[model samples]
Target chain A: MRIEAVALRYRYPRAASEALRGASVGAASGSSLAILGPNGCGKSTLLGALIGNIAPSSGRVLLGGRDLATLAPRAAARLVAFLPQFERMSFALSALEYALLGRAPRLGAFAQPAKADEDAAYRALEGAGAADLAGRRVNELSGGELQLVRIARCLAQDTPAIVMDEPTSMLDPAHARMVADAVRALAASGRTLVFSTHDAAFAAYAADEVSLMRGGSDQFRGPVAEALEAGRLASCFGVPFGAASAPSAFFR
Target chain B: MPRSPDDLRARSGKVLLLALAGLALLAFCLLAGRYPRPGLLDPRLLSSDATARAIVLGSRLPRLAAALLLGAVMAAAGNAFQMVFGNPLVEPGFLGVSQGAALGAALALVAGARSEFVVAGSAFGFALAALAAAALLARAFPFGGWVLRLVLAGFAVSAFMSAGLALVKYAADPLRELPDIVYWTMGSLSGASWRRLGFAAIPALGSTAFLVAYRWRVTALSADEAVVRSLGARPALSRALVLAIASAGVAAAVAMAGAVSWIGLVVPHAARLMFGADARRSMPASIALGAYFAALCDTIARAAFPGELPLGAVTAVIGSAAFVALLARGKVPVAR
Candidate 1:
């Protein structure tokens, strides 16, 4: 589904300043858009607004030409799936069981997941490269394995759009690569992707479009190549931006 | 994704077997009591003898039903508490439902309200009040997350309720009200009768049925609130609803059975170990297993000695032992 944030504004209940000051961004249907920003840049807040979690203080959000506020939560979820930041879960559900929970939006209130739901979960796990981890307890999984399982759950959600917050932020290089590959596949599968990340190179590699947010406002919004300039990156993050062609871009 | 259809089939089969075993135990508990002494009564007696039939139906049936209801309700409430609070150590009383009920009951006794209806009603009211106080307190402390804030608020209310109970006890008649308060706090089901069971059944059935029907959604409690919300769930509203229902069931159980310890705390854990932590499977398991545990405990309470043992004492010993055994076996995985 097309996601349009039309001049959205938000502030925490008791906070001194607005978290989002008239920020606007959009992603076309079946395309990948990355909200690239540094810490405390309101990337998470913007994603929250897009998903209708944080109601915009002013302006509004439209999901597929309908006011987002008008849709019921279940209907919103069916149209746009979400993958939140990783949770340090303590409960003992298997990866497969956890993934099957994605079918919750589709199931009736009193119904449990049927065989078709389980099959969908299996397919999602396979797509996420977590098929081997299906039987394993979620809490017992390593960081990479857990992230894969989480992504598999998102896959199982099977909506028209997916919104994610820092999908690879907590991962090691190898795991981050795995997540990056998964993100590309998700985008390629014709689902609108709205994600947040700090890694410019990774965003450039995965996202067709990029919107750079700095100091709680949109700094740049365009094609990834245009948004990844060194001077603009330096200003956005307050760090020297450099391109390294030393046979590896993972560290950058 | 990882599970086989055969494994699921086997589990369903196991559930059936467990249900059958639980039914048999309930029947056995009906015959095993101190009145008969040293051994179980003849099954033929249930039909042939009038006084025996009256005793079995009027007296034993109620107590047996009480045990079943107490176990299932408390276990189900305990499971919901743990899920909504996102804490493994939580129980139905962590939010002060039990203490609130005890305080309300104690006040009723001290006020010379001897009727069962008044006492149960007061207990139920206070139990719901405690939850309200916790919610209000949580709202006041908006800096933290829901689970953490609720936990702190509940602890505060629990302490206050305990103090209130103590004060009521200190002011009561030493001989009559003191013993009643003490016995009620220790928890017992000996007063179980058809009348009391009927009173408790409404809330018990309402809560358990709701929890069972919504068991799948309970999984959302273990996730981050953002994730829960993103999936089209209102975490606050959902938790509140579950807590209300669960606490109502707990209030009914406490009002009926008298502060029965350990079952509410340990039964859900046991269910999780035997089945996976998914509420869908473990919830039904909790109901069945709780009934079995309560029946066995009640039988031991009735049969082990010439006089009936307090139902609370027997369950405490068994529940703790099972908890320790579960830990030793490494099935619980309760990391500090």
Candidate 2:
């Protein structure tokens, strides 16, 4: 599915300033787009808009050519899956059970997941290299391992497009590289991917195109090579962006 | 908790066996009560003796039915509440449902409505009202997260209803209404009649079936909002569905058994320990196990003493002790 956010404008209720003011970006079918921004640049909010969680104050989003507003919530979910920043849950569920929950969109209200669903969930876990974690409680997993489980969950959703917010923020370099490889595999399989990150190296490794957001708007949208130039990167974050400023291979 | 398919199958087998064992216990309790001698009845006497037939058919049957229904209702309701709220500490009681029912029944009795139908109906009505009030108050707080807002609202409503119950008790005629209200709060099955059992069955059994039917999707409610959205389910709507169903079951149970505690909070966790945390297994596990536990406690309450003991007191003592033993064993998901 080709996801297009056409001039999205959103303001959190009673906030002093708008979180998104006419931000717009688009990803072609099976393409990966990297949303690069500093903290509070409305990247999460923009992702929220794409997933239909936050209604745009003006403008709109679309999947392929159909307006997102017209798609029922479950129908939209069948086409697009979303992963959020890490959060904890009080209840304990195994990784396989958690991943199989993604199939909920496909089942009828009274139907339980069958063997095929469980097989699909296991396939997704293996795809993300999390098969060994299938029986492990999600709450007991390390942050990086949990990220793999979350990716597996999205894979199980079987959507054409998947959006992830800061998927590598809690990972070590090795795990981050693993995620980059998985993201590449997902894109190579013809799934559209969009993710927000402050890590320029990870973004460069994973995304084909870049959308640099600043002040709640898309400051630049094009090839990552051009949009991630030192001058523009510095301007967005108010920090130096030379080779030394980039995330090091050893550590950030 | 079962991890593999084989283990899961084994756990299901174990659950089925436990259910059968519970049925046997119910039969034993049917013949064993404070029937002058406080012992099991002769099997042949049931068919030949009038007194044995009356005690077995009229008294033990209704009490056994009441125990089974109330126990299964509260524990399964608790399982749903824990999943929907994503907190092990939460149960139907945490939502003010019990307090609301107590207050409603107390007020009805104070107004000279002695009929079981009136008491149960009034209790069910007020229980729904309390849940509605909690939801409304939570919605009013638009800034905080939904889970936090719901917990805060529930706490406030529970306190308010409890105070209302106290006031009703204080204003009642000290000789008659006060004792009755106190007895109801202590939770006894002495009033178990066929009509009362019938009154509690619709909501109690119906809600349990609804929750068990939708058990898989209910896991989404325990997840973060993003997961719920990703799964294409409405978090608010699903959460409300779970809360409403569980609350109605608990309201009916409380109305019938009056303030029976601990089963809702403890048995679900025990089910999670044995069957894993997924509601699919744990919910049915809760139904079977809770019925056994409550029936056992009721048997002890009726037969272990010269006079009838309060069911609530016996359950709390045994329930907390069993929970402590489980915690000490170091195998279950206790609070997480």
Candidate 3:
């Protein structure tokens, strides 16, 4: 499936400036796309818009050539699975129970998860390497482990497209690499993967294409190599360009 | 990794023990009252003696049934409220729906509408008003989150209703209406009849059924909205619908039983302790445990003294002690 945004704009309530202004991008089928942006540059807002969590003030979002706003919640869910950056839970649900929630869209109204749903959830957990933690309470999981379980929940939805906002923002280097590898494997399995990241190394390793956002607008969109160029990276982050030190800062 | 036969037997025995305990409590509820009745083992008196039959089936049985139904409804509603709000501290009364019902009932009584229908009508109206206020606040302040908005709206509406109730009490004829209002506010099952039982039973059972059916989905509300939505559920709409149903059930029970406190707040916590917070298990366990607790409390209230004490008084005394004990034992964590 493909998703396209045209001239998108969004402003949070009571905020002085719009979070997103005329941002546009597209995700090709069965590919990985990374969104890179400085703090407060609308990366999260863009992810929200793509998943219909936030309504754009202007323009339209298209999924598989159909307008996103016109699609029913169930239909939209079947096509797109979204994992937000961080979610704090009030209840202490087991990790398996939390992951099984991903099968909700597939079940009928008022239906509990069947054997097939359980199978899907198990596969998702396995895919995200969270199978061993299934019985543990979500609150007990480490930051990286929780992110994997959250992704497993998205995987359980069995959607063709997955969108995540900084999926590895809180992970250590080893776990970050694991997450990046998982994203690459998901993209390889004919699923469209779209994620936002601040770590350039993860983006270099996983993203087929990269889109840079600055001041709530798309600064550039191109192949990973082109987008990661020293000059382009400096412009996107509003920092001094230094090619020699940039790669090591992310890689190490 | 296979379970041993003894372990399996022990598990089965534990289940049986719980079932027997539930049945014994129910039987004790039926037998303990102002008038003596034949024991559960002897069924002959129910068929032979008129007063025995009247006391057992007409009054005590219906009262027992109402207690059980209301208990289950309140507990289930409390569980739903806590889950949807993503706050374990929440209960059915958090959104002022109970107070709204109370305000409506008080207004009806003050206006001399003493019929059951009038009381229920006022209750339903004010319950809806409370729900609408919470929903509107949620929409108006999108950033405050549903729980925050609901709590704020509840506090405001509850304060308003409390003041209104005070006004009605002051304006009432102290000799006549004041006693009636005061008695109703304290809550009782003394007026329990088949009709009253029917009023509380239908809605209470209906709401419980709805919550049980959606128990799994309700658990998902603790996750991020985008994830829940991707799973084919509309988190906001589901939360609102569940809240409304749960509130309606509580309102119905309040209309019948007159603001019986503690069950809606405490029973869910008790169930969580025993059942480990899986709504599938917790919901049913809550229903059974709540019924047991309420019936047992009512039995104590009726038989503890020469005259029946108010149901609310009994519940408050017992509930506060249990809550404190649970806290002291570190069974229930302090709210963060």
Candidate 4:
């Protein structure tokens, strides 16, 4: 499914300024879009708008040419999957069990997941390259292992598009490379993918296109190579950038 | 790691074993009473001895059924409560359901209402009202997350209900009403009759069925709020619905048993220990195990000595010890 945020504007409850001021971005199916920005650049807010979690004060989000606000939650979820930056698990659930939760939108209110749902969860684990972790308790997994399992959960959702907030943040380079590989694989699977990241090198390696943001507005949107140019990076982040300091880019 | 198929098979087998064990315990409880010489009554006695038949059919059967229902409902509801609130310490009565029921029963008694139906009915009504008040109070609080606000609201509601109960006790006539109120607080199943069991069974059993049928949804609610929403569930709406259903079942059980303790607070923990924490397995396990624990405890409460003991006291003594043992064994996976 193609998703588009057409000039979204939003404000927090007691805040003096809008968090999202006419920020817009879009991603077509079978492509990946990386949102790059400095701190407080409204990337997360824009992602929230795309997923229909936060209502925009004005403008709108569109999913495949249909107004996102018109769809019910289940219908919307069926069209798009989402992964937040952080999630807390209250109990010790096996990886397979946690992934099975993604089948919820397809089941009835009182229905249990059938064999097909279990198969989907297993396939999702394999897709995320964490199939070996299926029976392990999610609470006991290391950070990178947990992130892969979480990505597997998003895959188990089986939606046409997936959105993630900071999918590779807070990880060492090795773990970050693993997540970047997962992202590349997901993009290769012909699904619409959107993710936010502060690592320009990682973004350039994994994303087909990049959307740069500063002060709650899109400053630039183009092919990753053009968006990552030193002048553009310096302007977007309000810092000097030398081509030599662009950092070690992860493998494609 | 074992595959998903093996995990499913193992969990199912464990649940089936628990159900069978529960059935065996029920049979033993039915036969082991003070009547027929303080031990397991020979199964052949029902055909030959008339007094044994009356004791088994007239008294023990209904009481045993009430105890089983009380256990199953409280344990299942307790599991739901813990999952929905995202707090391991939460039990069915944490939201003032027990205190509200106690206050309702005390007020009915002080109002000169003598019938068991009237007293239990009053309790049932107040228990639901207490849940509503807590929810409303939680919504009204501007600070804290949903779980924190609800917990705080429950604490305040319970304190107020306790104060109300104390005032009711102070105003009662010391001799006639005081002892009855005191006895009610300790909880007992001696009043289990066929009619009373029928009255409490409908709501309690219905609620338990819903929780078991919707077990995975309960597990989903146990995740972070943002995760639940991303999964296409309205966390606030779903949480409210689960809490209401679980609280209603708990209120019904409390009305029937008069503030039975420990079963609701501890049985779910045991179920999670025996089975994994997935509600798919632990929920049914909790129901079966709860019935067994309650029946076994009640059998001891009624048959261990000359005079009947309070069911609440017996369960507290046993449940606490089991909790300690579980802790000593380690691997609880409880979030502190």
Candidate 5:
């Protein structure tokens, strides 16, 4: 499915200023795009709009040439799967049980998961490299492991598009790379992948294309090489880009 | 390594054995009561004796049914509320719906509505009103998360209801209505009848079915609200619907069983302890465990003395002791 945003704008109910303003971008089917921005630049807001969590006050989000707001919830879920930046498992669901929640959109209103749903959960866990952790309680998993399990849950949705808000923000460097690789594999399998990240180097390695967000709008959008240039990076962040090198620990 | 078929069979046998033990406990509950003879097969009680039939059908049977239904309804409601709130500690009582019902009953008594219909109607009306108050509070304070607002509203409503109940007590006739209100508030199944059971069965069974069916979606609620919305569930709408259904179930059960306590709070935890916390398994387990516990408690209430004890008193005593023991064991996390 192709998702397009046109002149999108949004504001929190009581906030003094708008969170997003006049932002526009489009994601082609089966492509990987990374949103890069400093904190408070509306990256999460943009992701929220794309996933239809928050309505755009002034513009429209189009999914497959149809208005997102007009689509039914189950139909929207069947098309796009989203992973939020952070999640807390309130119940003591086992890893596999948690992953099976991804199949919710496919089941009948009152029906439990069938064998096929279970198989999908298992496969998604294996795909996300979290198969071994499936039997353990989710609360017992480390941060990185839990992140992978959540990704597995998203994968189990079998949606055409996946949007994640800072999937690797809380992980260690090694686990971040592993998550990045998993996203890359998902893109390679002919699924559209859109993710937001602050880590520039990780975005460089993972993104097929990059979009820079600043002041609640898209500043630049192109191949990573052009978007991640020293001049653009410095301007976006308002810092001298090479004075303090990108953390070497991230690259290692 | 793969388990052999023989090993799997042995495990299944152990499970069957435990199930049989549970059944034995249920049988004991059915047989033990205030009557002089306490055997299930005792022909003396079933020999067309009017008093015996009155004891069996009028008192014992209805009480047992009330206990089982109350347990099942409370446990199911508790599970749903806890899941929707994303807190295991939440229950129908914690949300102050029970207190609201109690206040409704007390107010009806003071107003001279002595009929059963008036009592059940007032109880349900105030229960829904309490829930509406919680919903309004949540909307009014959108800055606080949904759970926080709900919990705060519950406390507020509960305090108001308690004060109202106390006022009713003060206004009541000391020799007549006051004692009746006090006995009712403490809770009992002595008033159970087939008609009362039929009236309550609708909401109780209906809500239990809804909870069991929607058990899978409850897991999605653990994610962020945005994520839950993206996953085809309107988090706010679904939560409100579940709360209404679950609270209505509690109201019905309370109306029938006269404010039975502890089942809603403790039964879900017991189910979680026995079965892993998958709502699919936990919902059924909660129902079964609740029925079992309620039956056991009712049996003790009936048999512990020559006359029946208040069901709520018995449950509170047993539930508090069990809760303390569970905490002292230090197996489950104390705080989430």
Candidate 6:
């Protein structure tokens, strides 16, 4: 599915300022778009709008030419999946059970996941390279391990487009690379991926394009190389930037 | 774990075993009460002595069924409430349903409506009202997330209803109504009869079936709202529907039994301990376990002493003790 947000405008209730101000971005199927922004730059809010979690006050999100607001939640879910930045489980669930919850959109409201759903969950776990972790309790997994399991859950949703909020945040470089690799693999399999991240290195590694957000709006959208230029980086972040000093430059 | 078909089978088998054990306990309670003597009533006496037959069939049977029904409904509703609210500490009691029922029954008693049907009906009606009031108050509150708002709202409503119950008790004639009010608050099945049991069965059992059938959806509600929303389910709508159903079932049980405690709070914990946290397993386990706990408590309440002990007191003592033991074992399964 092709997800495009066209000039989304959103303001939190009781807030003095808007969280999103005319932000727009799009990602085609089999391509990946990385949204890069500083803290409080509305990256998360824009992502929420695209995923239909938040209704944009003055703009429409289009999923394959269909207005997202016009579509039922189940229809939208069948086209796109989402991964939140943070989650807490009330009870202990096995990794497999957690992943199987992704099949909920496909099943009846009162139906349990069947054998085929279980098979699909295992496949998703394997695709994300976390099949061995399926037996582990989700609460017992380390931060990186849990991320892989969560990614597997997203894959199990079996949607063409997946939106992730900080997919590689709060992880060591090795774990971050693992998630980047999973994202790359999913993109290679023709899944549309949109994610927000501070990891410029991961973005350059996995994303085909970059959208730089500033002050609750998109500042620039282009190829990653041009978008990550030192001049653009310095202006976007309001900090001094050197080619050698850039994290992505060093990693590259 | 990669739960195989065998694992699912094993869970089903465990539920069946629990049901069978509960049936056995019910049978034992049937014959082991203070019937012909202080001990077990002879089967031959049941066949030959008309009084013995009448006592077993008329009084003991209905009372035990009521106990079983009360425990099952409370536990099942507790399990649903805890799952739907995503809080192990929450139960039907946390939602003001129990307090509302208590207040309704107290008011009915004070109004000189002495019949069981009128009292239960009033209790059910007020219980639904309390739930609706809490929901409305939560919606009107401009602060906190949905669960937090509802929790605060329920707390306020519960306190209000409890105060109302106290006023009803205070204004009653001490000799005529006070003792009866106190007894009702303590909860009992001593007044259980066929007519009353029939009245409570529809909502209680129907709600339990609804909960058990939709157990997975209930578990889905416990997930983060974003997750539930992304799965094409409206978290707010699903939560409201499940809470309303669970509270109604609880209201019916409380209406009949007059606010039995502990089954709602403790039985689900035990169910989760024995079965995994999956509602598919824990829900049915809760039904069986709850029936057993209530039946056991009521049996002891009636047969353990010449003077009947209060069912609520017995459940509190035993439930608290078991809860402590579960905590000491360090495998409670509840996580943040």
- Interface root mean square deviation per prediction: 1.9, 3.0, 2.7, 1.9, 2.7, 1.9
Q: Superposing all C-alpha atoms, what RMSD in Å does each candidate have to the true structure?
A: 2.2, 2.3, 3.1, 1.9, 2.7, 1.9
Alpha-carbon local distance difference test for all models: 0.85, 0.87, 0.81, 0.89, 0.82, 0.89
Select the stronger candidate by TM-score from 3 and 5. 5
Query: Which pairs of residues clash in candidate 2, taking residues 3 or more apart in a chain or in different chains?
Result: none
- Tens digits of per-residue lDDT for model 5 on B41-122? 3536567677767777676777788788899999889888877887776677766678888888888887888698788778
Pitting candidate 1 against candidate 4, the one with the higher lDDT is 4
> A1-252 in candidate 3: lDDT tens per residue?
898888899999889999999999888888999999888899889988898888899989999899998988888888899988878766667777788888877877778887778778878999999888887877778888888888898999898899999988888877787788889899999898999987677798889999999988899999999998988888888887564543332342
The runs of at least 3 residues in candidate 2 whose Cα sits more than 4 Å from the true structure, single-residue gaps closed, are A245-252, B1-5, B325-336
Clashing pairs in 5: none
Model 3 ranges off by over 4 Å:
A241-252, B1-15, B34-50, B114-117, B137-143, B328-335
Q: Which candidate do you rate higher for DockQ, 1 or 4?
A: 4
List TM-score per model, in order: 0.95, 0.96, 0.92, 0.96, 0.93, 0.96
Candidate 2 Cα lDDT to native:
0.87
Q: Which 10 consecutive residues of model 1 chain B have the lowest summed lDDT? A: B32-41
Task: Report the C-alpha lDDT of model 4 over A78-137, residue by residue, as the tens digit.
Answer: 888899998877788889999989888898899989889999998999999899999889
Candidate 4, residues B1-336: lDDT per residue as tens digits?
235587678867887887788778888998997776878899899999999999899999999999999999999999999888887777899989999999999999899898999999999999998999999999999887888999999999999999999999999999999888888888899989999999999999999999999898999899888778888889999999998999999999999999888887789888887788899888988998898899999999998998989998999999889877877786455665
Q: Which residue pairs come into collision in candidate 3?
A: A105-B231, A105-B232
Q: What TM-scores does chain A show, candidate by candidate in order?
A: 0.96, 0.96, 0.95, 0.97, 0.96, 0.96
How well is each residue in A60-113 modelled by candidate 5, as lDDT tens digits?
Answer: 988888898899898999989999998767777878888888998888767788
Label model 3 with its docking quality class: acceptable
Span of ten consecutive residues with least summed lDDT in model 1 chain A: A243-252
| Segments in model 5 whose C-alpha atoms lie over 4 Å from true places | A243-252, B1-19, B37-54, B330-336
Q: On residues A1-252, what C-alpha lDDT tens digit does candidate 2 reach at each position?
A: 799999999999889999999999999876899999999999999999999898889989988878988888999999899999866666678899999888888998778889898899999999999999998998789888989998999999999999999989989988888888888789889999999999888888888899999999999999978988989999988999878754554322
Which residue segments of model 6 deviate by more than 4 Å?
A: A243-252, B1-13, B333-336
For residues B146-260, write the lDDT of model 1, one tens digit per residue. 8888889999999999999999999999998999888888888878888899999998989999999989888766667877787777789988889988988988988888878
